[model samples]
Target: MTFWALIILTALVTAVFLGFSLLRGRDTREPAAAYDLRVYREQLAGVDKDLARGVIGEADAERVRTEISRRILAADAQMQAQTAQAGPPVWVTITGIALVGAFLVGGAAWMYNLMGAAGLPDQPLSLRLEQAEILRAERPNQAEAEAAATPAPLPELDESYASLLNQLRETVAARPDDLQGHILLAQHEANAGNFPAAYKAQQRVIELSGDQVPADAYSHLAEMMILSARGYVSPEAEEALRQALQRDPRHGPALYYLGQMMVQVGRPDIGYRIWTDALRNAPAGAPWADAILAQLDELAFRAGVFNAPEIPAPAISGPSQDDIDAAAALPPEERQEMIRGMVNQLSDRLATEGGAPEDWARLIAALGVLGEGQRAIDIKNEAMEVFAGNAEALEIIDAAAYQAGIAQ
Candidate 1:
């Protein structure tokens, strides 16, 4: 045990040994009291002899005898008093008792030492936990201890990068200024082969575009961040797409998505309408007009919208082309007003004499490429005429449109 305890034990053991050795030599004999009577009688005989010799007068002799008797009694009384007076002080009595206890404890410990010692070695934590689990599995009757044995089940972790990216995209869209959302979206997108989108997202994060600050945020600048989120696509991400469509009904990407969902769920009307709307809003003479026209033509062919001949795409830089860029180069507020004016004028033309869906699609794609997302979206319906029930065309259109936003 402890040092002091060992010392105390040793001292006690020694004391006990010494006590046994000393006490054994002194006492295995009878007490001397049995032979003491003879000596007493002989002394009495001497006193009588002295009396008969008349060493003193009768009165003196009597007085002497009385004095001797008194002395004997006094001696006995003195012995008793000395015995009483020999009592130990409180400290001495307490110390003696303690010493006796120590000796007993020490002696026992020493005896135990002669017997032998037993012990075990430390084990790994995993092994220990495994053992505990085995014990619990073996006997589950102990209530309080059962909790330790039966820990809560571990929750499954999600690791889907595509799904995570979509979630981050939707979150940032809704919140507009959340750095974490931006970072997460950017990282996941990069992992999914959308490096450009990833860079855009990081830009927003680094800029700290919003007021909120999320703790434990790491910079999204490497392959590791993107890879970490990689896994199977998630339902949440799909739902996010749905939510996006709700906010902007003819959101071109969503328009493109309608056909895919319709096939799976057995409904294409909603999707057709969505694409139609996108085409309605698209530009008349922009370069993307032909592709938009083909998609709508094919979709209409499938859905029986019409058997109209495929409209051709006009040249990129045309004779009728206005100085759209010069006007757009103005301050955003001014450019927006100009776009609005252009939309009004276009709306008047369309109301008077309908434009081709290809025209609408081209117009929309051009505006999107120009970074006037709002202006293009404003005519999504007319743009949608290019791909009424077309999933393929819409898909390409959707990517371009969304990319425009992402890159910006």
Candidate 2:
């Protein structure tokens, strides 16, 4: 009400100012004829003074006086004619003011009606955040999301491929304990656009693996669930994502989905941070990298990051060519010492500042190669803890552990 009142007052004041100007008219400048008459009178006075001082001859003064008198009479006549002319009618002036007032106030009201949110109260940041929390809490569940989804039609399948897929599905259903079969069924079902079947097979795969299940398996389940729901990240899907992250914190797919879920729940600030980290650590050609890149700018804008940093190139973390060359130049005895020194440096760095999974894997492999089996095992144990939920990183470290004879 206060806002509307201020607008109305402003419009009225503007209209009144304009209307007063119209009534007063714009005839403030001196009339040309009146100016000419004043100049002529001044010239007559100057001529009389010049004659009184004997600066001009009688004949010259008399002639100047006559010319000045003639100009005065002509100017006076012109002034009288100008004064006789009338201005616009009083009614016209009043009507014009009324039209101006109507245009100002009516146009303002019309424009506001078209574009403004009528009667909507101000939404401060705190209120907005509270509303977002409520929205997040009330969002649809997995079943609801799936029910509401309109999945695209599956593409036509070739007869032989369809027959093989059917056989695989039947084999998996019969041999419930076959982890390999479940894995294959999950992959094939997902490819066939049967996300429900795909997620069921993936669940079976995870169940069969028991404590040995990798993050990818859970991430895959989440992906299938989201797909089945036409991209809605339901509670079930989020749980799958949580499981994946619990196994592998650096899991790209899980991180991407988690960021998406944050955005869905009105937390673009959290989403932007998650995506930035995911993109920073992501490998070349990672599937999630492209998706993150696509929406990151808009996400940053929503998160109030006006000047978001550029996406950095993937860091190349490994021994440099110079280090390799330096090691090669040393004799066998000295090379052993050099290798030990390098290993010690890496170990110290990992302990103090930490490093990527690749660095941990490399250290484990180096220890194994040095015939330090106990130390290699110890390092593998530490790497497992550091990489806890990250399946891909654990895989790399586990491979090194296997090569080192620290694991079967």
Candidate 1, residue 372: Cα displacement in angstroms equals: 23
Q: Write the per-residue lDDT of candidate 1 for residues 72-165, one digit (tens) a residue.
A: 5655565555432224454664565567767677666676576634233446767755664564344322233323333333333335434444
Provide the overall lDDT of each model, using Cα atoms, as 2-decimal numbers: 0.48, 0.80
**Residue 207 alpha-carbon offset, candidate 2, angstroms:** 2.0
Number of the top-ranking candidate, with TM-score as the measure = 2
Give the candidate number with the greatest lDDT: 2
Error of 1 at 72 (Å): 99
